[model samples]
Target: MGLYLPDAIRLHARERGTRAALSCADRTLGYAELHSRTNRLARALLTAARPGSRIGFLARTRTEAGEILIAAAKAGLVTVPLNWRLSEAELTALAQDAGLRVLLTEPEFRSAADAVHAALPGLRLVIIDSPAEQQDRQEQPDPPDSPDPSGPAQAADPAVPGYEAWLAAHPDDDPGRGGRADADEVYLQIYTSGTTGVPKGVLLTHTNFHAERAELEESRWQPGSVALNALPLFHIGGLGLLQMALSAGAHSLLLPDFTPEAAARTIEREGVTHTFLVPSVLHLLTELPGIERRDFSRLHLVSYGAAPITPALLRRSLSVLGCRFQGKYGLTEAGGTVTRLAPEDHRPGGPRSHLLGSVGRPRPGVRVVICDPGTGDPVPPGTVGEIRIASAHNTPGYWNRPQETTELYDARGLLCTGDGGYVDEDGYLFLTDRVKDMIVSGGENVYPTEVESALAEHPAVFEVAVVGVPDDLWGEAVTAVVVPRRDLPRPGEQELIDFVRQRIASYKKPRRVHFVGELPRNPAGKVLKRELRARLRQSHQ
Candidate 1:
């Protein structure tokens, strides 16, 4: 039999049954306890619905949420984790598209559940949040709350029920009902941000996840490593990290939310060995007051990615954290991370450190190639082109999007990552920018990431985003949106322009600069260039 994620969890439970597996706030769960609870939950789910059903879960970073994910994995159910940040309308639409048989939510999203139920009548809504009084009355006999059984379940007015009471009566034994999951079995239905179009689900398999875990295990991870959990669970970064920690028998310290102060405290108190952050969060941690006073001696690895890191900021982080700072580059469709800069590469004052700006070489089992964007032919090492990846971790295709899947995946099954970049002679990947985000000024290609990286070097600039605005003569003019340092005096737009001009070509410098309090970002902490383009169009009109 092929190895699967659930099988790994079962093995860990047997080997380290009593060892602490997950810690969130003050609550802690051991491996055996987690596995048993997840098994019970899986049995309960099996009793309620058939295997291969799509189930929507709406909750924050709670221990119960983690339990549900593990249970879904064991039960052969496709779990669709909805972002709490999405609107009710978006949630309803996603549920309908996924053909969700069940809508599981906490009390915090009760009203949103009602909205979704109104739109999707066939969905069965189960509220997992039990009232305090209900917990107190667990000893007393209570009738299990069942859904409205009077009428045929329709697609518009869905049935609603409670989860605690249903699971209380079910025995904690394997249901032995789910079909065997093969290498190609769809394990998850994660949705991408609908920036380019309506959000479509991305199907990932057991093989894809296991392949990624194997790659990580072969690299730097070790057993019993304590990793801090701060990234949102809805995204691949957070979910994949959690899976890696579990597979390694590591302890995961979950942060209820992502705040620089909270993260610093957890690192000191829990002795967190590894953590991941984007450029924005790294800046927040380094810039926070009294950061130097914190104890980060226990920190071993700090992996950063999801955006480009400025050389100056990277240098500052190295000095401040005094830890092994690595970089990862990948996308959601590739099951989280495909390339990682090793810990040894982070040594200060070394040649490897000088390549800090690069995204590093591809990891094992991943092959990367650069091809001309227009001609689809291989490009030279130094020439900029579209980056493509062939890996076992890549998704089979976009769910229900055959046309898009065909365009994204070539006939040979290589995934065409919509990123523009080039590989150096030494095989290090240097990202120029996103293909859609590239600015054409006077027929010259100007990558926004290059300009943004240069602007981030300015002492007074706190954050920056580069985009192209419509111009009559140039067709599109380079524009920069900046967030200045809070304590520093606002620098003139011309000063900011001059800052980038000194580092790059004159055409690449921002022709227009706008100071803003913050830049629009998605759930993954990537700046939404589409939003910036929309704002520019509005201003021009």
Candidate 2:
């Protein structure tokens, strides 16, 4: 009987039925329509799969994607958002691991969906058709404002059900408690992006999501606020942000695909008041041609997370966007965000300028403790250790992986984050490096992030990732892969290495520098250091 995602939307529908609940491109759904549509969609889903079943969604950000998410919650089904950027083999692996029996996909990924279905023939497919197909079905031009409220129109297919027609045929009655939903029910299962290892499903419940309500007040989300989200729905940041906006009865604008030009235009036209973008995207937006001409007056806050932002990129973004900026640090297992670096702490030259590098204090009701890696004991302030979190936002554990789940939590029931960091005397959290990414070069511990931060200050370096490589003298050598700025003259290997030497300890400096056009990254914008380590080691051989 606690506040679940569907329950929150139902309340919004009663209080502000005519207000826009979701938008993408020219399509918008008011709270009333969204409520009714999700109800019907929930019933539709119930007919296809039983309550507590895992439902897979393989597509980008769109209004229909949001519809399915809410509908799944109402129907007491667990929603598993699949990253479309992954390869077919990768998708097949995840589908198999999750044991998906039902999948909702769009025309853009129809072939990929078919491939997965072929692998697991038991999986049923529901396709979100294209506008052209809808136009062909009706033999008339579609209206400007009316762009298929449910989704795109029906495509001619006998094997798979059309999402729009399938949804419309179901009754709009509330599914209610018949689905056996409760606050403790597992509602979402998001897979880790596999930055460090193979992906594992993180199971989150209604209680975990409800904990985010505390953050809405801190974010200053109002009923009239409009948030533009360009991050893929499969990502935790994208889904969590949408939930926070909807929980506050605010409108969420989903950008199906992210292009620098498209996002800029959307913000200007839609008057987006809040948004969340990764550092890489922020860099792209600030570097876009004629970026100064765009109007961002309505933008009140830009919350960035998933990866750390370089000082140069952050400063440029502040000057160009002219809005408050907040930084967050969290993992998928922690249910989204745990800490925030507020706008007041983002100043480049202010008294607290040093705080710009910290991830700020823990959010309300969240406790962060740095623990010794070897002894599992609490570390003193400013001493680097594995980050541990205790909060209602923490997920129960991974799905179907009890062994790993058991290992995830410590004796104190705290989720042990594998990232290496320390809490400063002022309670601000500073990330040094991933525990697995830390290198021991000639008996000295070197954190790659500390080395990378130093190289980022170089004018010639556009982007850089530090990794460890094998050496004869040093058990592991620190190496740097750099993306040089197109406009600036590229520096020599020795010069770049020396540049980092001036900022940090000489031993932490990169022994070798490889200039690349771009560094490999996951969808979440985290550098694939493991991949770099493998490729670099192979080159040395």
Candidate 3:
């Protein structure tokens, strides 16, 4: 009777009983089945976990990953989808920090999960989608009457994954009692990539989902269509797509990882209607050999973000897929997207063509303001500053970090997005650079993204990142890290510098260029500026 996520699944169960809700490995699960599975999972979770328990999910994209999110919500638990791509140290640190009651992961990440469990005495490891259960019973010793303080024996047996046991033991029903769901209660905790240091967990309530769902409900996606979720589930963008697909009662293809060939084949074979990918995925798609020979006629929407799409890439994508594209602007703290550039805004020769470089306008019930970083006042249109978001979908706060939360969300309810950007007169949001990436050279502010964008326009520049290095005369001098396109000849460093100088103010040009084989980026596709800075510092002197 409630409107929580599990309630929505149940709604779809009765509304579209036989429709495929999730598809994996030639097996399509109908809504009725999805509803039953989630209900059973929820009941199992409720039995073992206390209210407000933390359940950490560590796996590549899978149907169960999505299931765990809704299942945890139904049990009044917080689902922390851990990044499986992180190093062992990072993963263990995160597991310890979240203090999870249970860790659900895949056999692929078994070692990582084992390492995490070893570090946290109270942590239980549950490996899904493998022969883990059969071997689990054999490998784990019989439980001793005495509790082990340094092991999962304190709670559940930590040796083996109980994924199958949870399913077989529990009945497929809501338990006919109240669960942990309430309007303002936090439902999910997604950790921010600790690019700066230790990643902070962002706490999002059901209220945020309600707001996000309201906007998702406005999508042009048709009922009973198929969607592709190639982005990692640990990322907000991936989880957002899953939420949208489930709420719409649409069939979704959950991928463990994204490869251009697999994505192309999946789209054609599955008749995918919609998908959201980072620009890197799009780049991979275009670079694929014989891609044009393949079928993509079923594609309806191709939404790309996390980084800006170059004009060259955009044109190639338009010619390749011929589907509507959308660009969105958001961080994990904002719950995926508060502003989106719609398909209409991406049309060539359209009135908004000049603004095509911009990420797009604010989405429904969202307001974007360019605030001066120094004074916390709104900057005039076309003036660069910190981009702030006022939206119903913003996270309540970062978990366990009040000072960081206070800085993130100002007194006026605006979430100060660490991204630096400016709004045009037409209300489009153009990304400049991360506020942390801004360089001060002899009293002038130089944004790296502006210089990088100008460099991206060059034919030979496959990728470029600009960082500042210590300069006695200028305080800090702009430095360009270039990755030349494999198909083209490499350009000289000064030639690249001159290209930027001509495109923007000469002072903003990268004074020195360093050519590299590739630019370092996290899975989300954001350049590792801090790494670049460190490398420069080590090399200098």
Candidate 4:
């Protein structure tokens, strides 16, 4: 068995040599080649990077994504995958916080990379696109009307260091003096969304990779099965998906980002048999053009999480894809996945139909509890409380923040998940609301999910987010931000409020309903309730 992550790649190369391992666009890398390339890159990186020094990547999901991460793991360097969607200032703050020594840049994010590099002059910036690619980009003529196809239309920036040249300088032989490495060392760092506050970096050790593996090994996906992953590589889902596929030596395809059309086409083209997605992505897949003609028959298991899925959407997915559905629940802090509703748990109308809404019982070697947030006492089953988790797969904690780390974990070695939810009598977990997202009105606690679920039942409602706004009399008034279904007329505030009152308690109904063109979401399809609360404060001010 592999002791560290890099050992897995080495094991695959020796045992599954010449087997196809990864695909991105038109390029595919075999396990042996992938192993060799990672070694070469690791040797080159060793020339500069020291143990614990952070190396960052600001590129989309591509072939280089795996190579960089694998090499970093082997060399004992910490890798930070930057969120390309963040502003230059936000990216700068994260890079500074990580004390980064190197950053790999992609052409699409050249401007942002340049800014980040300028802000941190001491940080080494290595452009993933070569010097010639940069020149070719400059030489391409811009059309009068459309944006430049090659890249940004701005004037050419001076040629900087190229990734290809950097890697080529080192020998392909395994410099047996591998970069620094250890089984317990922090191998990866992923930052939080910073919805509640500044994003903090989460440190994941080599052992942390086992959380999701425990469940994935039991999945129906076969060895060498073809799989496609469209989640952003920066997120835990994306990186963990790659590791999961590699665990079984499965053939993997990665996309730069998710698009319903690309995902459908890739599944059909690659004959992909397994894939995982967020609920939002699944909804978009259902809405794709020519979706009726798309061949999803090859898909064996379809897993989704990172956000809730309504029964309506789940029904649509089952009808459209004709595949077994798995509902998953996890957080970045938990490594990848802590629990999942098995495919059998998704029976639409079977005896255990109610389990569809639950994230499912914890997998083997995992422990979970619904506990009081303040006292850390486990609550009885069926009572909502902060979900606490104890697992060897859990991350060590935030990078370089000892105080924050100490506060995150309790004396029992269990960490409060910050998500408020309950466990059923059968040990199934049902999500209620986020602790920070809970609203208090006239001393009554209101979870937005209950109201949102009620409003979502309306035929005209498409997407909805519930928040609490300041009210002179009620202290905090329940407000619903809604996106109306395009095919129907918008529902009125009183009508929807009455709609909720009839379903749940009257106090939980929205006092006001605001229709929106769309809702703001992060990479993982999670609604930004923090942003909505900030908007309410600004309006009242």
Candidate 5:
């Protein structure tokens, strides 16, 4: 009987009926309209699927994406936001795993949706088109034999319904809590990045989200705040950011997809006060043409995470955006951020400036412990070990994976983060790297983030990923894959390696360096080191 997801919409609708709730492209929905539409969508979802069923959403960031989440919560269904960036095969695998009863997708992903439906005939498909697309379809009549473009898959399959039509058919009245789940029940099932292995669905309950909001620090919502939501909804950072904004009655400006230009334009035009961007996005923004001239006066805060951020990039972002920066450290299983690096800690030469390199202390109501990865025994402070966290925001477990779920926690019940890091004497959590990403070269342990951080300080190095490769004499050879800054003269491989050697221990330096145009990153801006390792191994073979 605690706070429900739909209750946020209902409360906002009653209190701020005429205020803008969500804006994307050329359309904006007021709180009242959003509440009413979600109610209808909830009833529609229930008509096609049953309560407790897994409802899937595979689309870009849009107002309809928010509608699906609120609707699923109201209909007592679990929302599984699928990554649209995934391939058809990957989508089919996740769809099968979730056993999704209904899938809400968009025209851009019609082929992928078709593939999923081909695999699961029982799965209902509903296409959600942008308002502009719908308007274009209404203006132009479809010609015979020509493939339908700028519209839903309704023409291809009679059974699959268009989202607007399906929603309009249902009553606008609130779908009473007859089928709603309790606060402890699963509300969102976000899949892991699967860098190490097969992606597992992390089951985050309603209480998990509520717990996250209660601990929000610098990113806390302010009244009448306009939030720019550019991250994809499939990622926890994206969905969680949207939820925080909506829950606080903040107007959200949704981006269909992230582009440096689009994000800059939206921030200036929309007068966005708060937003979240990954370090990679921030790098792009700082390097953008005429970026310094952009009117970021209204922008208040830029929260970033999901991957290791170099101090250089953080300083550059601070200089360019002229906004308070907050760093977050978290994963999907943690339901978002468990630690927040406050803006005050970001100062370069301040008394607590050394903490800038750390991910900061755990948020209120969260306890972080460093544990030996092998023995699961607590490690002393300042000793590198697996990061363990205990918090109300931690997911109950992974969906349908009891064995792995049980292993996710240690005997002490702290969720093992699988990240190698240590807490300093000042209580700051300094991340080294993913435990799996650690490189053991000639019996010396080398964390890639440490090497990458050092390499990133070089003027020529734009981005870098350090990994261990097969070696004859050594167990694994330390290798660095780098993307050099286009604006700066490219540094030689040995020169770049020597740059890191001067800063860190020589044994931790990269034995080999490979330059690339760009680093492969997942939707959440996390570098896909697994893919990079595989590529390097194949190339060596």
Candidate 6:
């Protein structure tokens, strides 16, 4: 097999032409059909635009999404999958910033596509899955001179064309002239919602994917595995798992969207061997009514990340899923994971068990160290400091923010993760809390994660976020926002505070509690601490 992702797909298609390569809701594409369709779409793209051009897809995860991604790879164009949940203004901004030439969208987003087209004059819009006859009718000579009221005549179908029409117009024959792309050539530009500001695009190369696959293959994956795709494809969790599944020549059962019942049904029906998800979704699956009635025997492994998982959730998931539960720690800049808590280490014993709060040890081919936040000097083991990682999987830098890139990626190319954590004597990595999220209370420092973890252990607490709120006496007091478990009695604020206090030090317990229906989170399931902090500040004011 070749190194590039596209080459791998091509090889797989040649070897197993009739084998199913991708599946979505009620749809499956065999290797042959996928390859031929992708090739035709690639030719269409190449004929319409130059190589190395940027193409954006503003659509949900469907069978066509995977095809379009692979097609862009074959066409030598960089594919930018815009998060379908992004607002029109946000989508337009991203399209413009990326300088996308062609935008492929679904019919539901026709208005968004129009907005994008209006904002970006150069973008060509192609509607995927739109009726073929409608495209033809729209293309038919638009009533010779019908531009009396309108300043300029527009295509009846504002979308330039449909994906099928474009593919139909192109020949199936491979365009003999193949383009060369280096390992360092930009492969994907995934934007991360900045905790402090606007989202910034993180540029990842083919080499990054290859490196990640190589590392992952050493431990987690093998050929013929079945991976469940429930995470959003726009985030690292979903895309990273997708790459791993594809690299292994495995079957990926794609979920159009995440729903506990749907995920459990897919796992049972598809014999899903491996899956990645956020802890919130895992919680739902474990606590879903009549969950024991569902068959989880097919699930061999369940990996959760994107947020700190509570020990209760972890233990419950392990027992309920009846599989190995692995935790990975990484960010968008790291291209995904720098460390992973192995399935074996996930057992109940030794430092590994003690370090459940930790994100585990650095993966093979990666080096991690805790350094002084102010000086950037390496700190002694067991000391809480900034976590830094060095690996091939680490992104080179943010797309265009040179200053921020330099700040995070040091001269030695080590990425400063901005998270505070320490490595134990046994080499397990434990995260304390975000340096920015740490609370200074009356000359004492308290980590919100520690308190949040304690609160999560309570039976009635479904989800919780802890942030530092202004306090005249303590300077900053810990405040907890809790989403109670379904139909659970609402515990008094003092009772909740006492529960955490009994478990941890009194000072670390939340001084106040606010019951809410849901914890504010981004689309990726990460708690928006900035928003939490803002809400807490407003409460005091």
TM-score for every candidate vs. truth? 0.92, 0.94, 0.91, 0.91, 0.95, 0.93
Q: Sorted by TM-score, highest first, which candidate order results? A: 5, 2, 6, 1, 3, 4
Candidate number with the higher lDDT (3 or 6): 3
TM-score of 4: 0.91
Instruction: State candidate 2's TM-score.
Output: 0.94
Q: List runs of model 5 lying over 4 Å from the truth.
A: 1-3, 135-158, 178-181, 211-213, 216-218
Task: Assess candidate 5 and give its lDDT.
Answer: 0.86
Give the Cα RMSD of candidate 5.
2.7
- The better-scoring model by TM-score among 4 and 5 is 5
lDDT for position 278 in model 4 = 89
Instruction: Write the residue-wise lDDT of candidate 4 on 1-541 in tens digits.
Output: 2234577678789998799998887778899988898888888777767877899999988888888888888778899999999999889889989988888878788898777777777777777864456557657875365355554323333235567767777877664422224657888999987766888999998877632444555675446588898988888888877877876778889898678888999998888988888877887898676788787778888889988777667777888888888888888888778788988788888898777778888867679988988888999999889988998778899988999898788889897789999999888998888986788988899988778878877888877889998888888889999988887877788889899899999988898888888888998788888888788778778
Per-residue lDDT tens digits for candidate 2, residues 383-440, read 9999999998899999999999999999999899998999999999999888988999
User: Where is model 4 poorest over a 10-residue stretch in terms of lDDT?
Assistant: 150-159
> What tens digits encode model 5's per-residue C-alpha lDDT throughout 293-315?
99999999899998889888888
* lDDT top scorer: 2
lDDT scores of the candidates, listed in order: 0.80, 0.87, 0.80, 0.81, 0.86, 0.79
Clashing pairs for model 6 are none
The model with the greater TM-score, 1 or 4, is: 1
Best by TM-score: 5
Q: Which residue pairs clash within candidate 1?
A: 121-154, 121-155, 121-156, 121-157, 122-155
Which residue runs does candidate 6 get wrong by more than 4 Å? 130-159, 173-181, 211-223, 349-352
Once fitted onto the true fold, the runs of candidate 3 whose alpha carbons sit more than 4 angstroms away are: 1-4, 130-161, 175-181, 210-214, 349-351
Score candidate 3 by lDDT. Answer: 0.80
How well does candidate 6 match the true structure in TM-score terms?
A: 0.93
